[model samples]
Target: MSQHLLHTPLYDLHVNMGAKMVPFAGYEMPVQYALGVKKEHLHCRDAAGLFDVSHMGQLRLRGENAAKMLEMLVPVDVIDLPVGKQRYAFFTNEVGGIEDDLMVTNFGDHLFIVVNAACKTEDIAHLQAHLLADVELEVIEDRALLALQGPKAVEVLATLNPQVREMVFMDAARIELLGQECYVSRSGYTGEDGFEISVPNSHAVALATALIEDDNVEWIGLGARDSLRLECGLCLYGHDLDKTTTPVEASLLWGISKVRRTGGDRAGGFIGADVILTQMETKAVDRKRVGLMGQTKAPVREGSPLFDANNHQVGIVTSGTFGPSITMPVAMAYITTSCSQLDTVLFAEVRGKRLPMTVTKMPFVAQRYFRGE
Candidate 1:
């Protein structure tokens, strides 16, 4: 076990539930409970699954210039983000390489940030160093995050706090559940209609316990979390995205708002603007990340080499797994821009053998995001 591992508020509850513990992103997390990965994945897809996501980093930025400071580090039009709405964006280096992918929710006077656990330390340092002196950066270390995901997630959550059903996807609101103030966002990584609830550490156990009491909700672990995100074609920071991959190569152009991309009134003053704007104008990205489906039963994995019909190494696999929904092995890889077209034939080097594969549209499994009616 790694000595630097941190434990979440629900760590003991997971161990008591017979979860398989593992170290992930410097945290002692449960990879799976007694039910295992496949079952947990299915449960979340077919029903509701509770996840402890406290390992993620949460920060609050406040001041008259918070939005301006954030715009300097990201490519999104933060100034235009409506209050009470959350937007997905990335932190970029000076060269346009992705430093980290994160979600920023505008709350009128302040902004709430949720970043990947692996990049928390660096993200905080970057913000503190670049933020204007007037802006206040506060790390919420005394909070815990929990996600309730699936088709029945809303049904389960509605029972606890009826107001949650009124929030639309990508929208957040402060609500009182069981007399505890919580920040509830209608978003998640599982590609399902879910809610991420942020609560004080002191009330974490009670909230989790209350949610778990619902017969429809089961405790899910990191193992299923990985499979769920994979089915949804979501990128895992360290594996799918890294300092070497730029936002353009990662197929995350949608994150850059049109106003920012075209240099609206704000103009292009953010980090990596030169390279990002150049890529946008020329569409000259070298490799593009795409989804791949294996023709055979073989399961491809990370570090797998990708080859074209000429047997030339074109790219490498970033993440892969046997998708429970598709009942086949699926993978994500970076391929030459010319060969990134859908239906392009390729091969994955699995266990010293080249397995037949083809480029496919992402989100191998359809998403079930619930937008409040």
Candidate 2:
């Protein structure tokens, strides 16, 4: 165990449950509990799986010019975000490269932002440097987050709080769960319909205990979490996205509002607008992140070289694993724009052997988002 690693509020509980502890993003987290990855993955797909995501950073921003200040850093239309709604967004540098991806939720008076753990400190520093003096930025370190994911997640969650059933995807609300005020959102990294609950740190253990007491819920670990998100085609920060990859090349243009894309009132004001706009007009991105499927059981790992039909080094695998839902090896890689088409044949250099692969559509598994009508 690394002494420098931080522990989540439920670290002791994970140890008590015989979780396989490992180091991830400077945290002492459980990669997989006793249930193992395969069982946990299946359980999440069929029933419900409880995940401890408290390592993520939670922050609050508020001021008279809060929305305006945030819009300067990101390309999203922050001013148009309605209260109780959440929008997926990215922080880009001046050159159109991604600084980090995050979720910004409008809370009527303030903006509640959830950022990646590894980039939290840097993200805060960047925001503070750019934000005007009137804008107030508060880091809420006294919170813990949990994710309940799967088809039966809503049913299990309704047992504790019935109001959450009315929340639609990307919608967040403050609800009372087990006598504690919690922020429950109908959103998750996995493709399954799930909810992420943010609770007071003091009540985290109690809430987790209550959820685990239910027979339908199982404690899932990071091992299965990675595979689940991979099957969903969701990008993992630092791996699939980084300071070098732009949102357009990552296929995340949907995050940028149409108003921002077109030269509307809010256009050309955010960071990297010139480069992003140029890319949009020319459609001249060099490489693209795509999904790959192999015919055999061989698994492709990160850093594997990708080759084109002419035996040229086109790209490299960023993330790869055997998806339990798809029952085969799945991978994500950055390939040349010309070879990024679906069903494009390619080869992955695994162990000095050329393994045949085909470019497949992303989200190997279908998404089940709950958009309440």
Candidate 3:
């Protein structure tokens, strides 16, 4: 490991629990614990899994003009985002490319944001440059983020705060957990019923310890995190998405708010509105993001070149892993638009051999979000 690698609040605890630490996004994070990636991946789907995600960037934006200032940067409807709700958005470049994806929560007087760890520095600078004079930006480094995910997430978290049982997916609130005032959101990246807790650094260890004490909960690592998100077809910055990939081409057109579309009020005012909205209507994009399932047990990995019937290079795999839930190799790739149809058979060259991959619908397992009845 490099001497300059950073550590999260749970670094010592992770080491104590026998985590196999690795360098990820400038942090010495755990890639897997003794449970290993395969078991941890399946455990999260059946029971609950605890994940240390404190390395991700958390920010607080304050003042009355904060929403209005943020509206100019992304092509999402932020101004009317109801208080106590969280929404997914991305920073768009002038060319309609995704700068970085993030989650924004309306906290009444202020907004809470979580961005990709690798892009936090640039995200903060971008926010500072465009925000109005009255808006205040605070890079929150004093809090530690943890994600509790799986089918039993609500059952485990309810033991800490019974109120959490009533909170639905994308709901955000301040709650007391193990005597710590924490920001709690009923959301996660694994496409499961889960909760993300942002606790003060001082209480991070205690909070994590309390959660993992449950037999249903076990520590999960980055390796399983990647596979979990991949199974859900979620985009990872710098992998499935980057500065050159537009949301439209990524099959993320649904993320663009209807109010921000071509003819709606307050439309076309964002940085890349002209190009993005045009692509939405014309569908002129030459390539698209799609899910690929391998025909055999062999795995298709990132950077593997994709091909067509005539051996013509078409696209490249961005993320691939054997999803424990499905017991098969699954991958997400960007393929030429003409060959991206569902059920379209594509070929991926791995280790000098062309393997068959079929274009498949995402979320290999159905998402199990807890929405209140």
Q: Best candidate, TM-score-wise?
A: 3
Candidate 3 minimal-lDDT segment of 10 residues = 262-271
Model 3 clashes, total count: 0
Q: Largest lDDT belongs to which candidate?
A: 3
Which regions of candidate 3 deviate over 4 angstroms?
A: none
lDDT (10s digit) by residue, model 2, range 184-226: 8899988899999999999999999998988889999999999
lDDT of 1: 0.91
Taking all chains together, each candidate's TM-score versus the true structure is: 0.98, 0.98, 0.99
Q: Which lDDT tens digits does candidate 3 get at residues 1-373? A: 8989999999999999999999998999999999999999999999999999999999999999899888888888899999999999999989999999999999998999999999999999999999898999999989999999999989999999999998999999999999889999999999999999999999999999999999999999999999999998788999999999999999998889998897777887888889999999999999999999999999899999999999999999999988788878999999999999999999999999999999999978788888888
- Which prediction has more favorable lDDT, 1 or 3? 3
Ten residues in a row with the worst lDDT in model 2?
Answer: 259-268
Q: How would you encode candidate 1's per-residue C-alpha lDDT over 41-141 as one tens digit per residue?
A: 99999989999999999999999989989999998989889988999999998888899999999888789999999999999999999989899999999
lDDT of 1 at 152: 91
Worst 10 residues of 1 by lDDT: 259-268
Would you list the clashing residue pairs of candidate 2? none
Clashes per candidate (backbone, < 3 Å)? 0, 0, 0
